[model samples]
Target chain A: MKPESAVVSITVNGTPHRLEADTRRTLVDLLREDLGLTGTKIGCGQGTCGACTVHVDGVRVLACLLLAVTVEGGQVLTIEGLGTPDGGLHELQQAFIDRDALQCGFCTPGQIMSGLGCIGEGRANTAEEIRESMSGNLCRCAAYPGIVAAIADVAEGQGA
Target chain B: MRPFEYARPSDLAQALAAAGPDTVFIAGGTTVVDLMRLDVLAPRRLVGLGDVAELRRTELDGDPVRLGAGVTMAEAAALPLVRERYPALAAAIDLAASAQIRNVATLGGNLLQKTRCPYFRDASSPCGRRRPGDACSALTGHLEQRAVLGASPHCVAPYPGDMAVALVALEASVEAATAAKVVTVQVADLFREPGDAPHKETVLGDGDIITAVLLPAPRGTSAFVKLRDRASFAFAAASAAVSLELDHDRVVAARIALGGVATRPWRSSEAESAVSGERLTPERAFAAGEAAFEAVARTHENRRGIALGARAVTAALLACRGG
Candidate 1:
């Protein structure tokens, strides 16, 4: 028996790659283990936790539940591929670092991804709205008020 | 996880043939993959259905909006049409898990997903529904959120999808398929009254796959009011999706469905008809809400469902009047 495996070609962090994987292998595993993109954390293997968040064709998806085959011809962006690193950081990333929004920093990537989604979709208009939109990304340290303030700062700044 | 053969078919016909006796089709895989990891589903051949282009469109054909089963809850809610015409459906999608899960979770998987019953999750607990012939743990353990309607004596597990509640209230239908046949069943008629077959949730059998959910176009007024423990992402404790038709300020037609409180997606057309033709004043709307749960059999934990469901009905009914 030629051990049953799925062959999928996907674009990760703007690079195209193909691999053979078991049906059970999550997109997160393929990203971290195979592609060497470990910026996407694995908080809860189940869908409840947002640690494994990544942008799939501009939409944030839980990497653990995402099958690599689903994104065969689609674009994927992990935290490593987020911004021009030598050119400083993305606005949300700068907000987190500037405001001390991150405590242990485990949830910062997921938080930034979700915040980007929020800002991109025009849902994070106010502090309350930012909090609601960012509810999916959990910080065990409960560093939420600062997170909200940082995201809200950007939203308000954009308006003024 | 048991190593299994995997094939991604691009279209429906290829998907149909691949869904043979030993093969099970996977879409989204939020639920099935979980079960597979837990050793609940043990098929030797797994068919992946993500590339079926037809299963991802949300289009209005004739009367209803048909959502391809592959469409994610997040994607469906983002559709401008659903946001304008069916806020309940959009709200239900929003209230399901969280933005991350919603993006990856498909409409078909959400509907076809299995129980949250702790015993069933255990796999060894052997609820009659989980195994061929075993005792129902829901009857003994926490049975508050168990089904009050259409529950078989052997199984009273609640149908745990919020979208199903809104769709049932909106009079939606679902398309199901297996290698042998393809068919449509009203969302209302999908879940059978629990009888001897405790494991079976809907008319779809072992080999069948849900293809799409057809949502009848909005006729009157509708809203979904869900009450949960958290203001954030959580399942409904008891919720109501109400669609009411008003004539000259009086309700002429009503469709009511309950969520997080029943075995199947609970729709009470009788309760809706009770307030039909009555002025949808606060009093009448309240009365209609109360009437919706007339025969609701409550257990130790979910006595709150009846009252909460009534309040939800009033809220949804008020939404119909749209200020």
Candidate 2:
């Protein structure tokens, strides 16, 4: 059977786009391949690796596990949308830079995205809490201590 | 993944009307999309249940707590009522997957999630659970995580879920909708042993949609302990959930369930009976754990898992004492 297509009007980072999406294509594919949002990297096609984490309707979720059509009419926020309006880096991104949280930088976008979710969910209160909450996003470079410190620095209201 | 049509139903009736043998109801899409990507499962239609408002409702004040099928694991875990009254369920959800997954994974989907058995997941491998005529690959490959209880000659892949184990111990029931009417099935009876028909996992009929999970009034304090290869983002090697009530140090009531050590969400009646009447001491809890796995048909590969399961049971039961 030919893969069915559905017209999906999704708002990404406050910008709306209407496209006919394949039912089989994941949200990550739609975001990167279709919308040109290359910041949302696909690490593990499965849900295990949180490299494709994004916010749908203000809730963080794994984009790889969701069909592009399933998120129609929903508001999505990816790594591209997380920056400040004046092209300034988001506080979490600045915190990662300040704390030297990233090594290979492959998982940084996801870590920052999930870190924002962690902070939004009030899970970045402490070091342990941040680690537990950020466990979803894997850093193969093993830059965990800095990652936790970065989240903690932001959660502690130290971000500048 | 194979090409399939998608439909988003706004209500239960519409969702039910769209159901068929070739159709699948997608809630979280965590398990469904993963398996579909592997070409392990291909359905003609995918019915999106995300817009069904009725399925997202949660009734906590009632005698039997009604948690809607669409309630995400993170949403369920964040509820103060659930965290305070049913800590075991909260812990089970908290310890599962990760925050990103919990935000999307619904309670109903969590219970119906597939096993983590590599052989069963790899479509290239011959798995009886995935294809009936195909031989069980886990039998000859890696049995380290296979079932130590409720296993059959055909398959021994353990059920890799923590929520169902906690639900079974708490005496929860699943409300499902069929073409005829809504029916309730005990959480313990929802899963089936991998017997001759290793392909069939649940008792629900084709096109049956789970509506909600009903939990009876809070029985007592409960706890969930999971033994895994790592702390987070990994399936349990062996885990236990225990609920206990004490009358001045003497045990009044007790319930126990095991996960990652069986083919189904295992409710250990023997463990409950062992700790029921007696004061729950450390030694007594250990004995209860021993009784929990006494009937298990242990083998060289799964013996360690059985031992870990026993210890997990003891740990969970002991944790419930101070709660």
Per-candidate Cα lDDT values, in order, are 0.79, 0.90
RMSD of each: 2.3, 1.6
Query: What is model 2's interface RMSD?
Result: 1.2
- lDDT tens digits, residues B1-323, model 1? 68788888888878777766667778877787777767777778888888888687667655667888999888889988888888888888877888877877899988877877777777667688778678788887776566656666688787777898898988989988777777899988887656877777688876677888888879886788888888877777777888777897887788888877677788877668768888878888778777866776556555676777778778877887874
Q: Model 1, B145: alpha-carbon shift in Å? A: 2.5
True-structure Cα RMSD, model 2: 1.6
**Superposition error at B65 for model 1 (Å):** 3.1
The top-ranked prediction according to TM-score is: 2
- Measured against the true structure, the TM-scores of the candidates, in listed sequence, are 0.93, 0.97
lDDT of 2 by residue, B38-130 (tens): 988898899999999988878989879999999999999999999999999999999999999999999999999988889888889999888
Recovered fraction of real interface contacts per model: 0.62, 0.92
State model 2's lDDT.
0.90
